[model samples]
Target: MKTKLNVGCGTDIKPDYINLDVADLPGVDVAHDLTKFPWPFADNSFDTIELINVLEHLPDTIATLEELHRIARPDAKVMVRVPYWNSPDMLADPTHLRSFSERTLNFFDPAFPECKDRPYYSTARFNIMRKSCYIRFFYYLKINARFLTTPLFFLARYLGAVVWVIEFDLRAAKSDNK
Candidate 1:
C-alpha cells in the first residue's frame, strides 16, 4: 500500500491521504506542526505528496523540502502549488512568508545552471517534470489592454495571472550518492 500525504491540509481532506496539519482539525489524520524538524514518519515512507497552497507559509522552505525529500522514495512525485510572486494572492495574505516564480524550484535541481555555482546550498535535488502558471481572472481586461505594447502581455499569456498561481510536479532525485 502506497502512502499519500496531504501536508498542511486544513479543512480539506481526501479519503486515503494522511491529512497532516498543525491544528487538530476535523479531518486531520495526523496533527503535527510542520515547522518542527524530523516529522514522525520513517524515511522513504511516502510515494506521493501534495502541498496545495501550503509552501509559502512555511518559515523555512528549503528545510521543509529537504524533509520532504527525506521522506519520499526515489522518483516519488511531489506536487506543489504556490501563489506567483507578482500575484495579489501572495501579497494580500499576511501569513504568506515567501513568493515563488518559475525559476524558484530550479534552485533545488543541481543540474540547473543556477545551482552549478553553489551546489552546497541544498543537498536535495528534484527533476521538475511540469509547471503551469494561472492568471487572475479579474485582471484579464487590464492586462490585455497592454498585450502587444509590453512584455507583460507575453508573460501573462504564457506565465499566468494578475493573481497567478503556479503548480509544479517534481520528481525527487534521491540516490545512493546522498
Candidate 2:
C-alpha cells in the first residue's frame, strides 16, 4: 500500500493523507510534537511527504529534515511550502523560527556533499529542482506609495513578498566513497 504523510496539517486534512500535527484537531491522526525524533510512523514508510508551513516552526532544522529523511522511502518525493523571508506573513507569525530564500530547499539534495555534514551546512549541500515565487499586490502597493513617489513595478518583482514551493527527491548517499 502507498502512504502519504502530511506534517503540520493544522485543520486541513486530505482524504488520501495521514494528517499529523502537534495539536489535537479534527481529522488529525497523530498529535505529537514534531521536535521529538522517530515520529510515530515506521521507518521508510512514506512514499510522499508534505511539509506546509511547518519547517520554519522547528528550531532544529537539520534534525527535522533528517527525521523526514528517515521515514521516507528511498527516492521518495517531498514537497515543501513556505513564505519568503521578505513576506509580511512570514514575520507576522510568532511561531516562525526560520526564514527561507530561493535556495532554501537545495540543501536537501543528496547529490551535494554537504548533506553528510552538520545541519548548519545544509544550505550549501542541496540543489534546487524547481521554485516559484508568489508576490502580493497589496504589499507592493504599500511599498510603492511609501518608499517611492513613482510606481516601481520592477522593484516589486524583486522585493515583493513571496510564497514558494520546492520539491526534492531523497536518495541514499553513494557508498563508493565510504
Candidate 3:
C-alpha cells in the first residue's frame, strides 16, 4: 500500500492517510508534539506529506523541516498550505508562531543565492523539484461574491490565486560518504 502522512492534521483527516497530530482524536494514528525530535515513523518511510495550515505553528521551522526530511522517502513530494503573512487569517491565529512570505519555502530551493553561507539553509542540501501556489477559495469569493456564479471565479483561480498553492518536492542530498 502507498504510504501517505498528514502532519499536523487537526480535524481534517484523509481516509487513506495516517493522520498525525499532537492532540488526541478518533482516527489519529500518532499523537506526539511536533516540537520534539524523531517522529514516530521510520526514516524515508513516507511517500507524501501534507502540512495544511501547520508550518506557522511550529516553534522551530528549520528543525521541523529537518525532521520532515528525515522521515520522507528520498524524493518525496510535500504539500504545504499556510496563510500569507499579510492576510488577516495569519495574524488572527494566536498560536501561529511564524509568518510566511514568498521566500519562506524558497529557503529550501538550491538555486537561491544565499544558500551557501546561511546556517539555516537546507535547500542546498535537498533538491527542490517543484514550487507553486494557490489562493484560498474563500478569499476570492469574498472579494467578488457577485462574480461567484460566473466564469470569472474560474479565471481568478487560474490567474489570480498563484500565490496560494505552495507545492514542492525535496530530494535527499547525495552523500559523498556513500
Candidate 4:
C-alpha cells in the first residue's frame, strides 16, 4: 500500500492518507506542532507528502524542507503551495511568515545553478518536477491552464500582484539515510 502524508492539513482531510495538523481538527491523524524538530515519524516513512498553503507559515525555510526530507522516502513526491511574494495574500495573512517566487525552490535543487554553486547551505535535496504560478482571481476561478501560466508569470514579474499562489511539485532526491 502506498503511504501518503497530508502535512498541515487544515480541515481538508483525505481518506487513506495520514492527515496532520497543528490543531485537533476532525479527521486529523497527527495533531503535532510542525515547528518542532524530528517530526513524529520514522525515517523514509512516506511515499508522498502534501503541504498545501503551509510552507510559508513555518519560520525556518531550510529547516522546514530538511524536516520534510527526513521523513520522505527516496523519490517521494512533495506538493507545496504558497502565496506569491507579490500577492495580497502574502501581506493579508499576518500568519504567513514568508512568500515565494518562481526560483525560490531552486536553491534546494542540486541540478540548479544556485545549489551547484554552494551546496553546503543545506543537506536536503529535491528535484523540481513541475512548478506553476497562479493569479489570485484565476485561482478562485479554478482555471489552471498551462498556456496561461507563462503569460501570468511574466505579467506578475513586471506588474506586481498578478499571481497569488505558487505551486511546486517536488520529488525527494535522497541518497544517504541521514
Which numbered prediction scores highest in lDDT against the true structure? 4
Off by over 4 Å in 3: 117-124, 136-178
Q: Give the per-residue Cα lDDT of candidate 4 at 57.
A: 97
Q: Give the TM-score of candidate 3.
A: 0.75
**Candidate 2: stretches off by over 4 Å:** 110-128, 139-178
Off by over 4 Å in 4: 176-178
Error of 4 at 46 (Å): 0.5
Alpha-carbon deviation at 48 in model 4, angstroms: 0.6
**In model 2, what lDDT does residue 69 have?**
69
Residue-level lDDT of model 4, residues 50-146, one tens digit each, is 9999999999989989999999999999999898888888989999998898888899998899889879989899999988876655446654535
TM-score-based ranking:
4, 1, 3, 2
lDDT against the true structure, each candidate = 0.80, 0.64, 0.67, 0.87
lDDT of 3 by residue, 1-107 (tens): 54899999988988999999999898888899989888888877777888888898999888888888777776666766666565566667899899776456556
Query: Against the true structure, whose TM-score is highest?
Result: 4
Residue-by-residue lDDT tens digits, candidate 2, 6-37: 99999989779999999999999889999998
State TM-scores per candidate. 0.85, 0.73, 0.75, 0.92
Model 2 worst lDDT run, 10 consecutive residues = 142-151
lDDT of prediction 3: 0.67
lDDT of 1 by residue, 36-122 (tens): 999978888888999999999999989999999998888888999898787777888999998887678888887688777767878
Clashing pairs in 2: 106-126, 107-126
Report RMSD (Å) for each prediction in the order shown.
4.8, 7.0, 6.3, 1.8
As a whole number from 0 to 100, the lDDT of residue 6 in candidate 3 is 94
- Candidate 1 TM-score over all chains jointly: 0.85
